[model samples]
Target chain A: MAGPSTYVPKSGFERWLDARLPVVRMMHGQFIEFPIPRNLNYMYTFGGILMIMLVSQIITGIVLVMHYTPHADMAFSSVEHIMRDVNYGWLLRYMHAVGASMFFIAVYLHIFRGLYYGSYKEPREVLWILGVVIFLLMMATAFMGYVLVWGQMSFWGATVITNFFSVFPIVGDTLVQWLWGGFAVDNPTLNRFFSLHYLLPFMIFGVVILHVWALHVTGQTNPTGVEVKQKSDTVPFTPYATVKDLFAMVLFLLLFSYFLFFLPNYLGHADNYIEADPLVTPTHIVPEWYFLPFYAILRAVPSALGGVLLMFGSIAVLFFLPWLDTSKVRSGAFRSIWFKAAFWLFAINAVWLGWLGSKPAEGWYVPAMQIGTIYYFAYFLIILPVLGLFETPKPLPNSITESVLKKNGGQIASGAGQPAGATSAPETKG
Target chain B: MAFFSSRSLKSLVIAAAVALVPAGSAFAAGDSKPPRMQDWSFAGVFGTYDRAQLQRGYQVFAENCSACHALSRIAFRNLMEPGGPEFSEAEVRAIAANYFVMDGPDSFGDMFEREARLSDRFPPPFPNQEAAVAAMGAYPPDFSLLAKARAPTRGFPGFVIDIFTQYQENGPDYIYSLLTGYDEEHVNPEGELGHYNPYFMAGEYIAMAPPLFDGMHVYQDGSPETIDQYARDVSAFMMWAAEPHLEQRKEMGFRVMAFLLIFGGLVYMTKRRVWSAVDH
Candidate 1:
């Protein structure tokens, strides 16, 4: 997709620096003067929102760890000390806690957008897989971070989730025992969890760099799923994408602050307030809302190993999604009714699975989970592969710009003013 | 025009159907009845704690509950802080002097007990968990975060709607319900040591005796001296203990939302101007 650089150094220092490192030039080519598909909807804003959330999470997380104690005996009271004693500790703690949920929310939206638009197809396969990598790391980071609170939910959740490893054949008990530093969830487990929790987000940040790099290489897929044919098909990333992302980020923050201030503890479990007691467990042991879907999958089958395999398979299926669909079409926009119906059903089924996951694994919920889990696998394994060959898609426009023109009554809208500096003539090779 | 095409229309119908279908089967565990959602003064966004109510709540705790339950996280000085009871420094000092706490090793190398200073935490009734459990035959939980720690489960749609309604009073509701729950005949256990409480989160029976009576204490401000009022007041106080900075948090939250909304408007206008030059 790279053609020619639009950035030129006006100053002598920039030129000198560009000659030595070209970091500025690289950034200029990749970000500032970078071209994106013009018709990207609000869904694309989540990438930027996620970036902001990551930075905020790092900052808030760094601050919380300063006041936090990793010891099992004192971790609970230490959190209390942060809430009551430290300056603006409540704000920092809530931002970190609520920020995790918001991060997951943005991620879910980002993933769904990819699914709905077929953003994972063809050349974007690497981009999609890298995203899955980030998602896996995020889950690990979030799980470790939750365990750091050292409360009833934290202790029991860690105990229950780590027990998931115990279903393995010969290595089962050994693996779980190694996961916990001792016989049970105690001080060593907490200390190690804190160490890794701090480490993984940075790793995620590293993977994010590669993810963004892969994205720029492939370029973006528009809602029409058409490739950029010329400069006119796209707009500059600076003012247009920047301003749009800024607006969406602010709106997202409005929701974030609603939880941060008025309903800070709403996303958190009540059992977390009580200090951890290994002797007794709460009646219900539930994971955070983000993990509910997988939790449901894990409990869907009657056998222990069956549930575990299904849970792992659920994520493994996403890695192969690029090949699974077998459809030449890149966007759901041009796809037939079967694709649309299947996609929406998959989405609603995933949400339904999450709801079912929160319920205790008993009674009608077990059957519902079993059914939901079956459909979940079917969408990836059967429906996507077969329907891709059978389904006939709507006729695609010749170009992204042509689709935009057709949408606007077959005429380009007004405004033929002078081009913004450096934005014109982006010269996309594709 | 593009968003409203056949694909979008299909999506709208499908999405509306999904929305109409309620989230799975609701999980109502056993025959446990849900607590009545109380209309707390500090329930919604604009809510703040009632100052007089907090003061009476503190008095109720001091007169009755303090013998077994310990407010270990709070200090006398906190009572004087803004957004709380906001008692005078003199009153706070008097309250601090009321309790004797274990202090530092003195010059004579001895841990001496003296009147608690403003910074000192309220002394616990028992030195350790074993002693407390031994004395009471069950643990007397500290009051620092009991309101938060005791929040009961809200299954399914109620929990889903709680985010919108800002329903964060489950703990206080449970506390009030448990306190007043002793009024019914079915509440008492067959044995002397334990009492049955359908509202008890862990089990159907509770270890502690009936702590509140009809006229537990006379309020200085002449508010209702009934058990319900005491239960409500103490529950509010416990909520404050669990989250002392709710007032400041909500107040700042409102300001942040306002700022984001205004900034959002300006950003939207800038976006419109930026996109105007680039036609399809």
Candidate 2:
């Protein structure tokens, strides 16, 4: 794939085009020669994996819409027709349903990868922040999409969530009215949500492109705790990184398929099968599993505004991650013992919050949720900040190459640098 | 070192500022109104006969109503199974062989059989939907969207007002009333407008005749051959056909959730591994 010579002849059309646009070569030169750290591991694959998921969701979603009816009268039954009557309707429906869960799964991994490696630090902060914005938009899109089925859960879940606007003090009632397009959640709400749900994913697609662009600009961080310096410290993104990402995608699909075929209804609600009855409520109303953690946080506070703020705050804290950490060190590997322990504790606490969210609010459930909620906030506020300043980091290698060579116990010749075993030489500066 | 510490301090300030902004307004808004229990229609599940039920109802319908009124939407395949009015393959051929369908080039087709395959679209009783619509006026609206469309009408205000006040049983009470409602004495001209089947939604009278027989199909399972049993079985089956994905959807829901948990674990582990080298 490498072209020979410092200059190569343009093709017939390109030769004519080259005269008009001199910047094309500059753009090519920048990207074609862009350096990336060689030590990037599997975690770096999530961004590309997320891109694949977005495309999968859009494609599956469009096909589903072909068979779907947005009208309130036919919407639920239309979904039923797709399930029972359409050819391979079962497969299409299951893929779209499960594809949603997978999308969230991938994005969470991508976001967490940024946190783990401090990918948001310095010049890369915009990329990480844009990812956070995408995450929020994704959450909104998924929420609206879930209501389109108009099943019992879909109906009630929309009612319960939209009703939250009523907690907004004086303007709350108006907000709720505006949201419903009437006094209650009905056909108009369904139509509007359907329109928006169809529209939002495309907007997310736009933001995602910006996310990747920013990422490419900052390049990628590596596990070696070093920045790319000489040409030897990096490798081209294609072939090497691309192949690795492809393998991960295949593996992800294998697991995804296991759920799609063997247990298609495993993530669904039983009450939804019973048509939505505004007159008769199901015994217990809960959202889909993915929303449980925030659901738990929402219920944790005694007051409505408190619960709303805390629930939103839990997500908002993520955006501030670029700044919250006080440590000079970037990687978790070199952080002090207490910080590592606190990280695990925080993760457990969040899981506990999710569990609490799924349970009906009762005597002990409220208290348990409150504690979990506190810990959830503490992890971001108290734990991350305190740990950053107090943690004593392990000595960092002088350079990315030094760390790799030291770990490998051998020094190969590095082009544009001193020969191997020249430890005495000053470390290459950025 | 001075520059590094300054940057770190700046980062801390930014983090604290973002985290604390929402803390001051932590009081959750109190819900002013009491939690309102939503009322849902139980009629579809409880009272209304499904196509399968109506199919048995169709057998009940055929032996009973076919002489007077016809359900033109139902096809031979519908009877072959438990859900609809047509007979089984052998029965359909034996029954319909006397009738003819339009054939290829010859203009004379053979009669329909009882059994159905994945390839077949539902066969229409009439030559075209237009003829069916013309025959029935409203074309006994397709039984496909019937359960959904008719359900709301079956739910009366009595049931709605009682739902929250009583919080009694789950399914629609009006359906149970409509199913067993037939009483000839209660059929006053003003009160009962039509034939007063009682099982009909608008109090007994309906344009369509009571389309069920006491014993239409012999139970292959050797269960009791009663009209009520047939009604229940057909209704349940229709419910299944209408929502084939119901069981699967619910099951998938649980599975997707389990998958999420597993995925969440993988994310946590992946995070740990990726961040393993990072300090604070």
Candidate 3:
């Protein structure tokens, strides 16, 4: 477990523990001495921010379940009881609810950073795939958790989304029934959703461990996207990445706390406050904002089966992204102007799709979504591969050190005699 | 030239595939305008509910709307809770004693009714949806969560901008609008059974008649009892009902934000100090 660490036991008890377990030595090696690319930017901090959000959600969720009742008859009233009677219950509930949204926000930024820098290229594909798996799990967990509130939106959202499985010819209806555990989504459905919602977060935690393992194996990708060539190009994870991550974590948490307390219901739909009434469906049925992009794609196609296929296809394409994007150059910085333009356009299209998804699927939105959906697929399947072959990229920097030195006029010494912890080092990690 | 020769046909094929997809032209059919925004006591990061206003609003609700709509989700104890109207425990007990609640079956296995307890939820005006519908010609929705249950959809740019503007008064705004939006000058075009209210989501016709009138409830606090005043205060109180912990939430937010800001500065300093070893 120690992996040939230089750590030596300093005490009799330490010596005995080190020989038997070596856990401390392993932690020291992995977290402390692990070499991270110095050129990593604030975007890299989202990984840490996301980790914090996940833990926050889990802790708050666990506390909420202690006060929560799973029965459909009691669930909505029980939630109200928790809010009104239990001590600090509102805080815990708001943290968990808002934490889900914040988690997605960080994940989206992390993913965008990966795409921009080609962090999924080469040896990091497995790591990226694990991340996608975690994302899917998060979505499942959030969807089920939303239903546990037993609100009108929760009931209808569950019904509409679960009905998507029924698009299959023979197994569809049976599959939907099995998923519901009944003829209709009822007490059984609520009970099962609560159970699954509680279970998936731990599964995500397990996958996260694997994600970190993969990341450690491949090392960190930097903004420059140049591979670490020498010891000078990397820095120890301790004090360097840790401090930067902490700074970003606090900043991110401030924004999260703002939503949690100040405008807690801003991101939420008003319909969710009403308890589930199967007979009375709201005029408009909308999913949570995070799912809106895929929701848009689901409505783009005229045929139900095609809509389901395309919706699943959108995510399925992501699994093949490493293969689809074949550029030798790693960073968007060096990539051709056309490639960068296309990347930004693709990003904008995704956001546009999300906006349109929230709109009713009729009139101009139908055509708009169709165009957005086509471009979304084409970006991955066509644009990436073709652009990789024909686009001319800019000249590469000799090294990260040289890139920094060139920007700084080469007159300044690169940590020649300066004592550490004196002042800020401008572009130290470049 | 070499690139074009190799990829031109493939690019053309892809382009054709993208463009050849048939377009459909069906538009969303609704003229529901975005609810007009209203200034609220609980609008900003630092905003807190006006307790006196909430108390008056609660009085209005108790005297008028409680006859038809129920507030089943709110327990009597919540009325006296912090961050709300903050009624005295004695007041809440007195209020609870006024209503009769169904109790459990006795040892003889017979159900009974008794005076409401402080912990009991507000009793429904109707025993069931069927009763409510039969009595009113429409099911009267419960008031327990109605404040949080109705808001106009702010499509696209409005929603995006709302994130930065912290614009979440839509629920209260819609409530206020519906309360005051009854148009006496114009008649319902369809001549529906329900009355006309332009602000109502279901076209011009609303099942509930205009519930608030001028001087509906006398506010002992010397606040105006005008219909408009009643509408605003009740909307504010409904917001408080929907989120009883809002004041405490905002207070905690400020403290947490301040702590995080200071902590962030310290982390930034630490980051700067730690990174000083390296030069660029």
Query: What's each prediction's clash count?
Result: 0, 55, 2
Candidates ranked by DockQ: 3, 1, 2
Measured by lDDT, the strongest candidate is: 1
As a whole number from 0 to 100, the lDDT of residue A190 in candidate 1 is 96
The order by descending TM-score is: 1, 3, 2
lDDT of 2 by residue, A289-382 (tens): 7788898888776666677778788889988987887877777666778776876677677667767766656568778988888888887788
Which ten contiguous residues of candidate 2 chain B have the minimum total lDDT? B26-35
Give candidate 1's whole-model lDDT. 0.84
lDDT of 1 by residue, B121-222 (tens): 899988988998989989989998998887777876788899888898998998888888864476443554577676776556678777898875988888
RMSD of candidates 1 onward, in order: 8.8, 15.1, 8.0
Q: lDDT by residue for model 2 over B59-88, one digit each (tens)?
A: 433343333333322345544643233345
Candidate 3 chain B TM?
A: 0.86
Answer with 1 or 3, whichever has the higher lDDT. Answer: 1
DockQ value for model 3: 0.27
Ranked by lDDT, the better of candidates 2 and 3 is 3
Q: Give me the runs in candidate 1 sitting further than 4 Å from their true place.
A: A412-430, B1-30, B187-193
Q: Pick the candidate with the highest DockQ.
A: 3
Residues A27-68, model 3: lDDT tens digits: 777777777776677988998888888899889999999999
Off by over 4 Å in 2: A1-34, A412-430, B1-280
